[model samples]
Target: MSAPPATSPSLVLAHPTLAERKHTWTLTQPEWGTALTLEEYLHREEYLTTVPLAKHGGVTHWILTVASAPPDQRPILSSCETLRKRALYSTTAPPGGGGVAEGIAHGVGSVFTDPAYRGKGYASRMLTMVADELKAHQGTLMSPSATAASSAADDKRLPPVAFSFLFSDIGKKFYASRGWVPHPSSHLSFTTLPSRRSSTASSDAAAAAPPPVAAIGYHELAELCTRDESLLRDRMSRLPSSLEAHQAPSSFASTPPDASRPLTYVALAPDLDTMLWHLMREDFITTRLFGTTPSVRGAVFGHPGRRVWAVWTRTYQAAPPAISANTLYILRLVVEDESAGEEYLAEGLRAVIDLAREEAAEWGTAKVLLWNPDGEVEGLMRRSGLTFEAVEREKDSILSLMWYGDGPGENVVWVAGEKYTWC
Candidate 1:
């Protein structure tokens, strides 16, 4: 009889500890880029030591390695991270009329495989392991309160998490094969700035026209969070109800039978303390990336009581035309004055854009990209004299928002005005 074929090398999943941080950092550098040095990365970790997500079991990190790899070769094959947060789901019941559920949202980023190990199925096996971990952790996520718990238990008896989501730059079909479906409810828009000559002319004419009164002012992210915690929370709490009535039905809507209701939705539920910590962390990253002082990259505009905030970041889209330059990204936008309606929100957005434009000019970029803005917000962008074009969905390498879960996965929307770039 022929000798039995040698068994294939098994892959092992492990979490990097403090001792292995350098190794982990080495694996991520090529994918995350050279702007962030190992020292800066370590500093960021030290600064976020108290961030609520990690403290409360809200985030987890993992790495995969080939158990049988030779000692001389690097064993780490791939890595990813997940974040857990309290996601709110709307209900028809009274008393605030919404319920809070925990979501172990899988970010699944920094998925890099060693070049020598590519085509050997390491990435695929690692993703399968991630899916298994998410499924196992689903039951452990908690409901917000006794009431929400009862409501969730009474409904579909769904898993603790409504869904796990990831923003995939990789091909959609690649993730699809791993059981992730593109979120049809979300889309991206890109706006090109008017020529520099026209913009400069307009600025000079406005300057000559009048000594304009500053009705709206802009402040740093930390200061806004400090001064407007309650207002921010109150405004954030209402986003789900507002979107349910206003946003058009997503093409991907399935389940719920009701076309109007979202299949899955999320808002930033960070408490006052958590928000401050998050902003500080962002400031650190901004300073490192732009060589500007902390908090200079983001601003909150409008009156303190009725405010809008926008954070800026540099991004590169490596699609057609191959842009590898600075592109201003609206990292987060929020309108605090709910009763003021879309027009007021539009005005606030415009003010923030003006500030962003100044910064963009300084950085020598003429392109701006806005993440998933609801229908009302997009309309406001159009009315403000900015022409926006939808980014075509790609089978692979589109900014794919894919989710996995039983509860309204297709209908889930992002309501929290803030976007976590680190996540």
Candidate 2:
């Protein structure tokens, strides 16, 4: 008797239909729903779809399935979402108008697979298909300069997007295998409690001293973001294009040999719209959990040319079995005076951290978290006499990036790889 071998079905990846999207949510609710009931989690997902940042097709949902599967069976095997974002690309040192171009980049998030389908390679297959769609999808909004090249179809054709990023919660190797090289994954953390004094008198005296920084609210965030973007552009303009010059050499095992293409510097601008996406999400979740929104958005110190400020958001978590505790995370920390004396700069940074601690205390968070501090910030933290823990994140929130442009991927320096950049 002869036996016949069975072939596996081909997989297809595309946008999820309305029913498929909800089905995927229902599947993942047990994993990430936390304190919310299944119904409430579903409602939150619906609300997020209508946020300003997600509108106008800025956010897209994708799913993978067996090509021959019937529609009524809910064939979704894996799913994820991509967020459209504004990015800056340049190949020149000074970055003149001709060299500077504004285009779209994407933030990947909400990756999930059916628990029953584990070890079947479905997630990897889905990511491979989504990556292609991201690179070739048309109607990408770009500046006129960015779209000036001739096209076989349209009068002007924009170049493929340069890069995309995601925060990997499962560790580095998984995403790195798929082209997302892991970046810096360190953070500075401090408890919200004030430093203990030796005596009651000393504690009272310390409490009597005025706060070192000023509180910034939601209304001021947009203006601050604009200023931050200008400064970011200026700083990146002065930076060298070579990745070796920017930081330590690549240690990622999957990074390929440097290509012959020209080196380019790309940055995801910390603009108003980007900040709003994060802030809106935080406000939505925290308001629903606590019945009120957090009032202080960030802390500021110094003035004009020499100021230092930090914008932060509160993370609300249900107690116990959830491994992550409630926290106040500094989204963006700007230290304007890189050349200032150690003593002066440290003092300003200290004030900002103190304000952050106070804000964390008010919100009942356990700690304040600052991610990927620059060399200057690290130096000041060492000398400022503030007690803190500097640790590298291994398992979660590991910043990962994948390059898709024509230029050398090794040359892409992720400027301001802070918490704000996370989707």
Candidate 3:
């Protein structure tokens, strides 16, 4: 169907307040699909209402509706949530050793259009409205001094949205038409077949290996929340600088061998406090939504001496192609000390994989999926005897990582370590 007239003043963009949450919830239920139970929906609603981030303005949800419809018929046409964050973007410096340049980014997710309203351009209109809102907000934050020159400089120095991003189910072309580009990254999937060999052989080989020297332990979110803040803070502070790089600006001259080149990459760099808050909030919501059943759990894994950590949650797969009935999604995996080397991170990952396999066996599923695994971790997983297969084209769900505003799309590479998606 053709889009509604572009100039129609009857269209309304709104951010529903707490008083209108019930109405908003009802509108969203259809978008969430019939797979989610009413109890699950109520759990999500409660979590959204209580999360500290919402109160602090770190997140906001938006909706679009027709202004002329009667109060009961003013159905929400499209909806999405925006996460405000200072994502880290980096580019290699010119040859003589200037470090990577860094900048902030904004993350968007959970975009949905009412099924009955699809093909009418509601989603596109809502996206445009959200982009405008973000652009204006970024302008205010980047230029508190508010000088014309500063504003002009901000326009040139930053992308139209500073940095806008979303994971698209609609494929690259759909988003590309709206000026968003796919992130340069790869997601890896691995499957472990159930062992048919007898338990005695497996037990005997394990007894022969020197007591599995690496110390691996899992702690629930409740326990992690009580751990000393200084530990996590120090770990976050010590992460590598290259992990966060900005795209190179167009004006920079090509540096010869002597000048340091710019490092180009996209990353989310939440501080220790923010990271902790995310863990607690995610745990609160997922536990209630998925329940305390054996199929799901929210926890963190730590290696010997607490030198490395990874956060993850195991739950039943709800998305399509049925790759597996159960899956473990890694939220963030970090090495507090880079000097620990790939082997160290590899060992931590292997432990997590082992745990996942054990859970999968118990849950009767055969595969594990990792979204947007970066080169380093991907290499380690391969080295640890895990093989990857790209989701078959016919079965693929079109997981497109699209970005908008500022910097050339080619200069940015989205890595998986810092960001977390509940699904």
Enumerate clash totals for all models, in the order shown: 10, 0, 20
The sequence of per-residue lDDT tens digits that candidate 2 reaches over residues 1-423 is 111111244677656666677788898888877667788788877777767666555677777776555553646777898887778776563436325556677789999988766666778887877777777543322222221222222644545566788889999899988878777688899888553222335647766564557788888888888889888877766765544454534322235436443456667888877777777888877767777777778888888678889999877666323425888889999877778778888888888888788777766678899987876688797798788998888889887877787655555656677788878
- Residue-wise C-alpha lDDT for candidate 3, range 330-384, written one tens digit per residue: 5555444456667766665676555555444544455656665545666777777
The CA lDDT of each predicted structure is 0.52, 0.72, 0.49
Please, what are the lDDT tens digits per residue for candidate 1 over residues 1-423?
111112234666655444444566665665664345767766665455446554444455566754554322425666666665444444334565655444434445566665655666667778778777676443222222211112212433334554455656665667767766664434344544333334545747755432111322224445654544445444444544443464455433223324564434455443433444455555565566555533346556567667776666644322213334546666666666656766667666776666666555555455666656766777777676655675644542333334454444445555543344335
User: Against the hidden true structure, what lDDT does model 1 obtain?
Assistant: 0.52
Worst 10 residues of 3 by lDDT: 250-259
- Report per-prediction Cα RMSD to one decimal: 8.5, 6.3, 8.7
Winning model by lDDT: 2
Q: Is candidate 1 or candidate 3 better by TM-score?
A: 1
Cα error of candidate 3 at position 364, Å: 6.9
The parts of candidate 2 lying over 4 Å away from their true place are: 1-10, 67-72, 93-100, 138-160, 194-207, 243-263, 319-324
Error of 1 at 341 (Å): 5.4
Error of 3 at 386 (Å): 2.7
